[model samples]
Target chain A: MSEFDEGTAVVRRPDEAVDSSVFDTELDKGWQIGGGINGGLLLSLAARSIGEHFAAARGLHPYPVSVSGYYVSASRPGPAELRVETVRAARSHSTGQASLLQADDEGRTLERLRVLAHFGDLARADEDVRTSATPPKLPPVEQCVGTEHAPPEFLASANMLERIDLRLDPAYVGWALGKPSGEGRIQGWFRLADGREPDPLSLLFALDALPPVTFDLGLFGWTPTVELTAHIRALPAPGWLRITHSTRNLAGGYLEEDCEIWDSRDRLVAQSRQLAVVPR
Target chain B: MSEFDEGTAVVRRPDEAVDSSVFDTELDKGWQIGGGINGGLLLSLAARSIGEHFAAARGLHPYPVSVSGYYVSASRPGPAELRVETVRAARSHSTGQASLLQADDEGRTLERLRVLAHFGDLARADEDVRTSATPPKLPPVEQCVGTEHAPPEFLASANMLERIDLRLDPAYVGWALGKPSGEGRIQGWFRLADGREPDPLSLLFALDALPPVTFDLGLFGWTPTVELTAHIRALPAPGWLRITHSTRNLAGGYLEEDCEIWDSRDRLVAQSRQLAVVPR
Candidate 1:
């Protein structure tokens, strides 16, 4: 794993029992867009904390099957506490609600983020059903344009892009070049910059890592997410992950984007849907 | 609006503040599937209560943009109270968390359902970006098969079907006729059985009202939903909502389904994604 990956895997110091797990970590500025931490990075941090707690306490490997997070306040790049509370624990699955809180100097805690997630056993296997959808076809990674080589203005401003390696499908490079495709869609390959094998937790970040598909429709600038839900279908295999983000309608000041992530083996590993606001 | 729509629109008794709103109503037996109230119907009830509260208290017509619900316990058909608590109210949107709780003989309350929803103003409008995806082509409602006319065994046991009108796309009728298509997809048109004009709240029910798409992949029995998120793009235009439900992969004992709802004008009104357990 890269140094950034190691930095993000900060361990949480449990308070007392497994029911409530607490962690304090310094938000890496590298994960910030503008002054606040990227929402997907925060989600990944929360998922990792909760997943570890469940795995340790229940002796069951808790693979995040579904996670929905509502951003209550902007998460700044500083000290933050993630408190995960177990809501329910059943034989087959477990549910947890977590809050990323920022405290004031007076020691009063304020919620910055909230998430509800369900975890199921990742080791469990199932019979494969015939699938009609195929993995998106894209050129080799070397042929795609990496965000690292993006314009100086974008690379300098979008600090979060520096933390992860993202390569855009050649067909979508026009959007980054200020040419609106008029198609609200983006396809790309992504992986942790530190060479960490993609896991369910990483999938959480990957689901929302893409620039809002709305950008391709000629709307740009902070497309704040209202709520995001991701379903992890399978544990991703090692190597880069391919993702396709697309939007169907942009109306009522809100647009919905659906993302599909395919693993190295060309298996569909995760799917996500989110509602986001267009920049004013 | 029809009697059923009126009945479903139970009034909430607020406690003199915008923070909390309460409503008590009997869980309609017609909304039950195998004894538990339908998850989507419960979501609709919560959204209605929260929407009403926000409208009356803040003068904001907070239509649901996104709603994610995690069923904590099986909601039985009986009296229940829905308590909606304001999570945050911003200038452009408001967030609320709600719980459908049941009280035992001793007045001990138990949470049966929990939901987090973001509401955007129905009065707000924005310039539409061009959309590339079109509504699915399906047979007219008159030519399609209705679930009400299903086999006696299915009709007798599936009580929830009686509460809504669902007309299956002709291409998928073979699945209902016992032929597994090996394709996990279903397209249909849906609306309230009572002929109420389809609204944002009703769209919530319509999102999950269909049978689990996993059934088409030869995986049968109860495929209980783990988490469901729906994004309302535009308000429906008072007619049967066209919906297409499809699944990409069924692996790791779980599967993800995506649903798109289009108004009569062929405009996409809402989109939904959910993770559900495949029957063991």
Candidate 2:
């Protein structure tokens, strides 16, 4: 019996001392409330930092800023590193490239990312643009929730999506979900199950998880995001991350997915685009 | 002249051809380089098909799979009208969506995409992969290709980038014929003087272009794509489409690009990605 935050996990055991092998040492620390860091966590961390960099560079603070796009390339884990290089710095908008490196013990590059961001230009809101219908809203996290399933694969997922406050908003809200395979288009909401603030890379890794929810049988637990790109519209306050993903229209077994992230304010925070092939 | 194969445009005088405003009116009737009716031309037609419906349905495709990303909600022009609907035709691998609309005065969906694709059950290329410094071995279409004042507010972009064939093999070969203005990252062996195929979009179009190269800029004109997710190993053929693009490292301005498409033989088709700023 422990207390939990709205979006964070509540660790109930730490001293239980579970037997661990290769994955036990660093992970078992906060068994009762661990959500510290993992692959997705790093991505989210990276995203946050990159977003902040843009917000400041573009003077887009106070007002929300969205993530324009993200490309997460897969690699074996190693030393965590982030290299941010600017693309353009303008009076109104600013763009840059960020790469995160997770190197092996030998200092070799493993996985990394190159993120693109546009900041300070809220001017588009004034332009004659049509915002996509708000994805059907979801039951507040307070309504209902699910417990965590710590499968070996989940652990292997690098904690990117370790703790998610997920729900399929409403009926007909999505094409893919906890039902028959959909036409690939999906819609839903997500948040840190533990409510812990994850980094940008961490968020990206977690996002890599969402698009494959329908494709992965949840059996072997191997969902590889060959390539992932995200576009951000806003950086919502940490809590829940809303999203919609689809792949059903997959051609050549090859498919692509576009996802958007939203905050409670209804402001679009980020968009994710991905290309993956489900192995038959 | 050398024999033009499929996908090659059949040149015709402006008056000798149908009105250009009417799409599919044959801007240039070229050899049939498509499967029945699928090819780059058809895909472009299908892409500009239904801006609203597809945006509404939010469907994704994985076959003949489009490499378009970066979408800016724009007003439909007076070309024709279209309505894209994602339909699950009775097919496998090729299971995909279609739209119905008019490419002419009759508001009809003259174009639709049928996919014949299934996820490759084949194992991913071995984890131990490698990339070729061998580079794409293709001569640039000319000393300078691409267009200079193509039209519209494409901005700073000179000739269609038909200037040079960028090389990444053996060593990175880069040659930009003009000095463009924009505080960001730019790369690739762009050509000029508009002497190559008239592409529809580049990977980084702010105009609704998708990926493998999900980019940020408004995809306004024709831009080729080259490069891909990366390599644990070199490709089957680093043909002419093989090109390399990076932020080239940004400082005060930006640093980003998107995907660079390459020919099966590794010739540089187009390179995309993006860049941003860091401020001093």
Candidate 3:
């Protein structure tokens, strides 16, 4: 098998200009919903390209402290071009906008995704404040139910289910059985299918890897994300990442979900908030 | 006082090209923090500009569903140019990037703020989901303690205190007396000093108008925001808006806070999440 056989192909560099690169959406095919790539994977691809640009252009090892992505259009499989524009470069932080585009038959570039990311040094410690929120209680990863062996119903419908190792908390798996918990919360362990070590970029995918928390409230189907913002609190340790997702309000044909990611060490690694359209 | 005396001046249009406009930051003088305008005010200005652009260019009444702002530099109080670029104009939503820039003596514009915002229609209603979160309990606006009459201690140091009418939940006010509740939560009522009706645009300012919830955790001083994202859930009713702010994790010299706004009818209006440098 090729080295880029799995999701790593999403970050494979191209022989293009310094500010641009090409990505293959083949690895992301399994994650597709409603005939389009998952929004989380598209966001991660844009972030990976922007991070590379920050490193090559400004010599900054940028861990995205905050990333806001607007899903302009659905990204299709095949080749896509990522264009990066440096909005501002400072000593400690740099801000940039990256666009994921595809070429039409006439070679006109069409935008599929746009993201704004803020990069900072995660290791730089000045003054630290103790965290007040602790990770939620969950069964060990081994004891949890992995999606790899999900029911034929979900597997037959969602090919993306096989791309990652998602061990959902047993208490919340009722949704898979057509019995939702009636609560907008989910907690579980998540890791990429290819077993790459978790990093800031991977955290982007991890944050959105789970199905919409609204699904537990009997709102099912493809709840596409309108916009998503993720904040990196600390660099994650190498192991299964614990994710706690909850939604406070669902109103006016829209809902917002907030997620907190904790490393195996119980360190808060990242927090994300997203606005999505409620399922019909 | 002229017609542009109050909050209306914050949205003053510039008679320039469709892509650019100018803003007088003098209207923001009262909201200063550490000799510069508060980051929230700057974000609101950017949102206002982008909203206007969406309205003019696409004929859509753009309420910001998601806004991400990176405070690249401290904005000086004066006239600055707000340049808007339409990133993508879709059928129901339009995404845009706006930069707030300050010009030098020679008219070379220097960028001070960069923002990406997703605008959606506030009037469009589709299938709705029930909200699970409730607004915090607080005294009536008439009985609550307004910042207008704050003790000389806080009022003397924070010049921004006088520009907004904030009624703190008395239970959580011990921090003002150097007695912290040991919890990172703050509930309050907010409205403009000039008594403007609270709209989707004004809700942006109200979300960040209060002091950081970290202050309740015994941390103080200017906790500058590195990035902020706010989601507009519903249009607010005309009355004092209820705000509930809380923090989950504060570590590695950074912290994240979440805020929820509710109109007088007890309906959720907007929700915001921000990442800021921890107070030293």
Top candidate when judged by TM-score against the true structure: 1
Global lDDT of each candidate: 0.79, 0.33, 0.76
Place model 2 in a CAPRI quality band. Answer: incorrect
Q: Best by DockQ, which number?
A: 3
Number of backbone-clashing residue pairs for each candidate, in the order shown? 1, 167, 1
Q: State chain A's TM-score for model 1.
A: 0.92
Q: Can you write out model 2's per-residue Cα lDDT over A146-194, one digit (the tens) per residue?
A: 3232334344433443445556544323322334333444455666555
True contacts kept of each: 0.61, 0.00, 0.80
Q: Where in model 3 is the C-alpha error above 4 Å?
A: A1-31, A105-107, A148-157, B1-27, B104-108, B148-157
Worst 10 residues of 2 chain B by lDDT: B206-215
Tens digit of per-residue lDDT, candidate 3, span A76-164 = 66677777877778887888788888876798877887888888888785546576788889998888987654445445656666667
My TM-score estimates for the predictions, one after another, are: 0.92, 0.42, 0.91
Residues B112-191, model 2: lDDT tens digits: 22211111111232232112223434444454233232233332332212232332221221112222222222223432
Minimum summed lDDT over a 10-residue window in model 2 chain A is located at A18-27
What is the per-residue lDDT of model 1 for residues A95-183, given as tens digits with 9 covering 90 to 100?
88887888767878777778888887776757555466689998999888886644454466677886688889878766667786877
Model 1: docking quality category: medium
What is the per-residue lDDT of model 1 for residues B190-279, given as tens digits with 9 covering 90 to 100?
Answer: 888778888888888889888778667766677778888888887789888899999877776777788989999888888888877777
Chain A TM-score for each candidate, in the given order? 0.92, 0.59, 0.87
Candidate 3 local accuracy as lDDT? 0.76
